[model samples]
Target: MAIATPQQDTPPSELAIEARGLVKRFDATLAVDGVDLTVRRGSITGILGPNGAGKTTTLRMLLGIIDPDEGTRRVLGHENPRDVARLIGYLPEERGLYPAMKAVEAIAFMGALRGLPLAEGRKRGRALLEDHGLGEAADRQIRHLSKGMAQIVQLLGTLVHDPQLVILDEPFSGLDAINQGKLEVLIRGLADRGVTVIFSTHVIAHAERLCESIAIIAGGRVPFAGRVDEARDRIPAQVRLETSAHDGPWRAALPDTARQVGQFWFFPLPETGVEPLLRALIDGEAGIQSLSIERAGLHDAFVAIAGEAAAARLVTSDAGEEG
Candidate 1:
């Protein structure tokens, strides 16, 4: 077998971030192995995976926090991200803020590191604080602020230099529901303003609610990518129905895409036929009460793919423990 080589004429750059066969090894273990990612311009791209699923490792290698052993990756049109640091906003899973420094000071310091002018950095910091509802805490020391506030500051510092792409790693961790909602809104607002936002999270709802597109990664590889609906479409559209009687004439009148799960009826339609289904149910006196098609969401897809990998990992871990 012959391996394909890169063509002499490479294609023009159109992606915000492009990675091919990315591999990163920590000692003997491969944290990330042969992952490909393409984040489009002016869109929110989500990296979805379970814990230790190599999402963070992939992010780090792409951002130049670490280098891949044998792969190609480009961030904001640069193969070497370090040179493009000023044009990228990176909110790492771990906070990079100075615990003893004031909120505004820490934010300004990060901006300065990105080579922004001191006055400009300070001005950006102030705007960020005001925008994220942290205006009052701008003067307070980072050590004195709550975790959520500090997180907001970290995010602010990332965006202070007005980077073209924002990479947020687990940005919603340890936050209350309200804070998560605010963060999701902020992320969507960034995408709306034409910033290519790439973020990773264990929280499925955040990814589902905020991102227009997503990549589902597990065991150091992407099982799915592209539009969220495209990925969801890979799984059948399952509409669940609850009826009064265990048996009904509606069963015979079921849509071509219908199936049964115990007493519940599931319809996997190309499109919704809720009205017809409901009418049939009512005619048959099946006492149908509820219908839902939103079940075939990212969560269901993630589970369908990654859940097996996770279960296998658990079984291996248990075997090792016994051994």
Candidate 2:
């Protein structure tokens, strides 16, 4: 299927999705707090948050699956989402495919519902399957395919219509590293063709690797939104050092906040260069085994801005899932 691209004279609003002060309530609980988000055209943006941080709720409101209690949203420049629903493709977190249907049939069926002709959908579906290394499974029933294969088929179904904007909710929730890598490549291909991609993922590394911009949602609100580098800048750089001398004048020169992890010392990089510290160690005859300066990653920034508690919870959940 051909991807859609912006026209030379396309309107000045080069945005795929925009929402301001969005809020949602479910009975007695507030599911989504006031949140503002912007997704640029022809770029991949990530919505990152913990399990119940309202990522799905925010997407639902933007997709017209549900209305926000307070705030406004525009998708593809349409104030009303339904007006542009057909121009967007969405893959929900939940897997929903008929077990009895052949893989190609299921993909084409979904496309047909979105106004894609069955014949054309089938042709594209076969091509998509072949391109994704699933050509042999095209005739197999959903029940007989591996979980990863089924997932790929569903994603192909989402793309069968060649939507201008694609929304994926927790697209990597359950997949091995190889399949996850494949999905990332697929997402990049879509953006390269001028298609906008907005995906929600709790895995910080995924956003750090794939997103040009991201919205960091926590506790049902977005606390940060901007370039990926901006998020990483929220925290200072870090340093790790190892030495033969455990205690000496060199040790005294180290910051009081320095922490020891096994045989290594870890701490935030000092405002000054390592020259002074190195000189101190040399003067005191402290043998430097190793040293490394590291920049803050998305996880570090998330912890600094969203608080250790939330970061800990997210990390724990991620570990459990991966295990």
| lDDT by candidate, in order shown | 0.77, 0.85
lDDT of 2 by residue, 1-323 (tens): 11112222334398887788898999999988888877789999998888898999999999999999899888999999988877889999998999999999999998997889999999999999999999999999999988888988999999999999999999887777778889999999999999999999888878888999888888888888888888897877788899999787788767899999999998887777778777877898779899898999888888887888778756423333341
Per residue, candidate 1 scores C-alpha lDDT tens digits across 1-323 of: 11111221234365788788888888999777688777777889888777788989989988898889879888878889888888889988877677899998888888887888878888889888998888999889999998888988888888888888899998887776667778878888888899999998766767777787887777777766677877666678667787777776867657776777877777674354567766777888787766677547666676676676653432111112111
- Model 2: weakest 10-residue lDDT segment is 1-10
* Superposed model 1: Cα runs more than 4 Å off: 1-12, 242-250, 254-264, 270-295, 309-323
Q: Candidate 1, 143: how far from true, in Å? A: 1.2
Residue 260 displacement (Å), model 1: 6.3
The candidate that wins on TM-score is 2
